[model samples]
Target: MSEKNRDGKRTARERLAVEREKQKSAEKRRRTLIVGAGVVCVLGLAAVIGVLAANAGKDKKGSEEAGPVVAPSGAQGKDSLAIPVGKDGAKSTLTVWEDFRCPACQAFEAAYRPTLHELADAGKLRVEYHLVRLIDGNLGGSGSLRAANAAACAQDAGKFREYHDVLYANQPEESDDAFGSDDRLIELAGKVQGLDTPAFRKCVKDGTHNSWVNKSHQAFEAGHFGGTPTVLFGGKNIYQDQSMTPAKLKEMVEAANRG
Candidate 1:
């Protein structure tokens, strides 16, 4: 063969090899892009599932027919787990609607715990606790409902007040879903004497009071309440008034008793 023709054939072979290499590199890039897209899609799906599971309790109508929601003994209003703080038939009724996951409710409880307990212990008035789950609905977590259910379970064990106080005392950050876990709830129950029993554990884990929690939230909405820590004195919504204080609450109760 002619030298020029041989050289030209070699050059052609070299160019073909380069083209093949470029094709292989492009195919590798394409595969990488496809793999990356698949990974993103999977991650996005996982995030969506996580959000849905966390927010499962946000729906007020969920699992309403799950079981019979037994209200606590002597519970007032519809689906409430009322813990009476004073003597029966005390002239005044101080109704409170609170969510365990609510920061404002925690603050209210802290500020008024002393005065309210003092008045109740003195038999001057009756405080009716109506547990609700506004926080769970507003925030994307089941902590409020789970905590409320646990409180109802406490009611069954005859330690509602003790458990209620401890729950608020150990309340996690409003945004955290720690209370959504039954283990954390049971752990907190240890703080209340005689509350960490087998029955209590079963009730908390099984979500025995989930239906009741839903019902209580229904009642709150039915009553047209705006948010958590709603305080009503003599059927008058008093929590909306920011000026109201613990001292004022005492005076209001005294006057109601006087009437």
Candidate 2:
């Protein structure tokens, strides 16, 4: 009876050990899964933040107040460039020359895009966007030439609107962070859909076709532009005088149509 008792005790001990080992293995697996999940969540959040920052850094700034708060136009010009806004009353084609890094350019976009949209929708204004990069400096800096080139690269991949809208929307706070570095620009480039990222990088880094941007910059500065959103109608320069409200812009456009 004593020997039988001893054997029973040994068997019970072995079973207990097995159970404990099984529990230990399960705990290890749970910890591993938890760690993996945390990593994924962090990565996703980082991506979201990057996108939002890029968008905000690209829009709105101040400009000159001279002729009309907004540029004016006549009946839609013949075979000129247009982004097409509104189809009401008279139609006029207007050209916009913009520098990506300019604060005034940013301000102009915010003030004008809605009216332009309304007019295009109403067959009133056909606005042609001529994106002019005026940023200059190294990859890690911001300038007119740099901005123009980067934007041009973005355009090649058929992401002109996305890139344009994003940059204009994100116009950086007027400060050291605005003319963002090459890495910053590349990061900004990543947010747009269908933009070929690697190719865009190669183009901006190598300064390929940089001359194209230089010429535009020279032309703008020489043209006596003191601010962005320089408006031209049928080859005539539209002047700016005060801070433009939507109402003011419409007034100018209507008056130009009459003249």
Q: TM-score each candidate.
A: 0.73, 0.52
- Compared with the true structure, the alpha-carbon lDDT of candidate 1 equals 0.75
Best by TM-score: 1
Which portions of model 1 show Cα errors greater than 4 Å? 1-65, 79-81
Best by lDDT: 1
Candidate 2: residue 54 Cα off by (Å): 31
- Backbone clash total for model 2 is 52
Q: Candidate 1: minimum summed lDDT over ten consecutive residues — where?
A: 37-46
lDDT for each candidate structure: 0.75, 0.54
* Per-model C-alpha RMSD: 17.5, 18.4
> What is the lDDT for 240 in model 2?
53
For residue 137, model 2's alpha carbon misses the true position, in angstroms, by: 9.4
Query: Ten-residue segment with the worst summed lDDT in candidate 2?
Result: 62-71
